[model samples]
Target chain A: MITPITETDLLLFYYQEADEVTTSIIREHLPENTDWQYFLNELATISSESSSLMCSPSNTTLSIILEESRSQLEHTL
Target chain B: MNAPIIADGVLIQRYMQGNQAAFETLLNRHRNRIFTSIYLLVNDRYLAEDIFQETFIKIINNIQAGKYNHEDKFLPWAMRIARNLSIDTIRSRKRMPVVVDSEGRDVFDCLGISVQSREDEQINQDEISALKHWIRELPEEQREVLILRNYAELSFKEIAVLTNTNINTCIGRMHYAILNLRKKMQKNTVRVK
Candidate 1:
């Protein structure tokens, strides 16, 4: 009997966290299943867009951190 | 030929040996993702900056004290620290009374709508601000999983371990978070048309 492919399984597969057998099953199953295929595409789009929204700390914060690191190095030396 | 990228482990070893440049390189490499993860959780840029600084200070102390054993897993380790600090600050803030401006409006209310500095930049910033608002609306658990997965870039297994939950629960939360965000975006698009 074939184990049912679940949304959770699709998520694992999308993130490349599935084991080899599950990965193979997802690979074979996705192309033949339109709903699953659409779901995968949605995951890809959402993941890509969300991950692209990168934010950086202010330069003042960066300077403080670097100074901290420098002081630590001096203490170690 | 391009220079081969130095690994995080090598950088850590060099930094431990008093190489400040190596540590800077390491910090710059993962800075944005780490900052974004903290900011998303806290929903305030200034507060996020404070937590980010605190996170790195602790990281430097830990490394110098020879307590940084995670080696190649620097981003996730740093992210875990940042996440913890953000959570603590948030909890404390919740206990305090809300701060409002002279106009009797919540000071934080204006923060969600980012200022558009240029005409060309407005649309992108608007979209990002909308997405941020939607993410903030999500349940805390789902939002945490999404941030750890996408912003922290932790694998499901790593997230499971960091969050102290089973892998299946993490994945399920992630699935729901994505679906909910997608639904929000689609609804927004339809409304805009």
Candidate 2:
């Protein structure tokens, strides 16, 4: 019987975090063709959007400043 | 603004030694990632921009004053500052009770993203939008884990370090996130048919 993959199991696979046995099980049980396609698509879509959200403009500026400040400080000290 | 791409550690060493150009290089390399991190937390582009600028200023001031430390962990440390500030801004709002509700709403509403990827054309726009929207509704813990693990391509150990969480908890959160997303997608697919 081709058991449906659980979210937990799928997550481990998607992240390449699962052990070989579990990974093999997931690969074997994965939905075929369009089913897997849409599944992968959905995961990518959400993850990308959330990543875009999490990294803020302020964070970028801070990175810039940190880089510059540290460099400048290194030179001075 | 314009500097060579030196390693972060090297840049930190240079900064500590008073190399201004080295500091700028580090900032340029990481600005976008850092900005996005802050933007996610606050969900306000304008406020995020302000905070982003402020974070740099604070860092620069600290460095000049010889107060900056944690050489290797600088980026994460700065991120910690940005996160704290963004959270503080949310708390200080007049409608503080409603902030969480509204932040989630705003993020969810924007789930319909127009991806500019080459393969995007192959995907149905509505379906893509729906999928993205559903992911947005996931719990913050799950969402963060998903982003770190997938989007940022951070390993569980790396994510654990970044979020100050354990590997098991990180994996668990990611599991729940995927599970919720899968359930939502299944429901949506059924509704469409």
Candidate 3:
């Protein structure tokens, strides 16, 4: 009997957190399931697009952090 | 030949042993993701910077004090500290974060876009701003799950632990967050058309 897939399963599968058996099941099921295929594609597109939305903190903040670390080292010495 | 890339655990060991450069390498490597994660949670640039600084300071202190124990899983461990600090600041302020600054700039305005023609850049910027705005509009729980999963690069299991929810719940929230985002994007596209 075929196991029914949940949206949670699809999500885990997309994130590569699914077990090997579930991964195989999803891989086998995707070819025969257009809806799941579309969902997976949407998940992939969202992941790809959102991954680029990184922003850096200001230089001053970084400088301060490094200075704090240096001070800590001095205290330890 | 290229030098072998050192793992985070090794870098932590070096930093703990008085090698500041190792800590610098670690900071430079994960700075963007850590900053962005805090910014998204707080939705204020200045506040985000403050929290980011605090997060790293706490990390340094923890490492020096021998409180850092998560081996090789540095980003997620740092992210948990960042997340907690952001949440504490938000709760203390007793207000939800706004999507735009006082001058009406987008919270994501600091994100770097690829170089392109002015017109194309404008279009791309507008689209990214809209996407980020939609993300900011999501329910707090859903947005938290999405940010932790995507920006922090935490596994669902880690997210579940961080958020104090079960793994299935984390996965479910992520699924709904993606679906909600897609629906909002589709609706916006229809309106634009």
DockQ of candidate 1, scored on C-alphas against the true complex (2 decimals): 0.70
Put down candidate 2 lDDT per residue, B14-38, tens digits, no spaces. 7667677766776776676666665
B1-193 in candidate 1: lDDT tens per residue? 9988998888988999989999999999989989999988887777888999999999999999999985448877888899889989989977876668899876655565322223224335435556667888999999999998888889988888888999888888888898898889888864211
DockQ of each: 0.70, 0.32, 0.57
- Model 3 lDDT per residue over B107-148, tens place: 545444212233345445444466666778899999999999
TM-score of chain B of 2: 0.64
Candidate 3 residue runs with Cα over 4 Å from true position? B70-72, B95-128, B190-193
RMSD of every candidate to native, in Å, equals 4.4, 9.4, 6.9
lDDT (Cα) of model 3: 0.83
In terms of DockQ, which candidate is strongest?
Answer: 1
Off by over 4 Å in 1: B70-72, B98-128, B190-193
Judged by TM-score relative to the true structure, which candidate is superior, 1 or 2? 1
Model 2 residue A72 lDDT score: 51
Task: Give the candidate number with the greatest TM-score.
Answer: 1
TM-score per candidate, chains pooled: 0.86, 0.59, 0.83
Under CAPRI classification, how is model 2 graded? acceptable
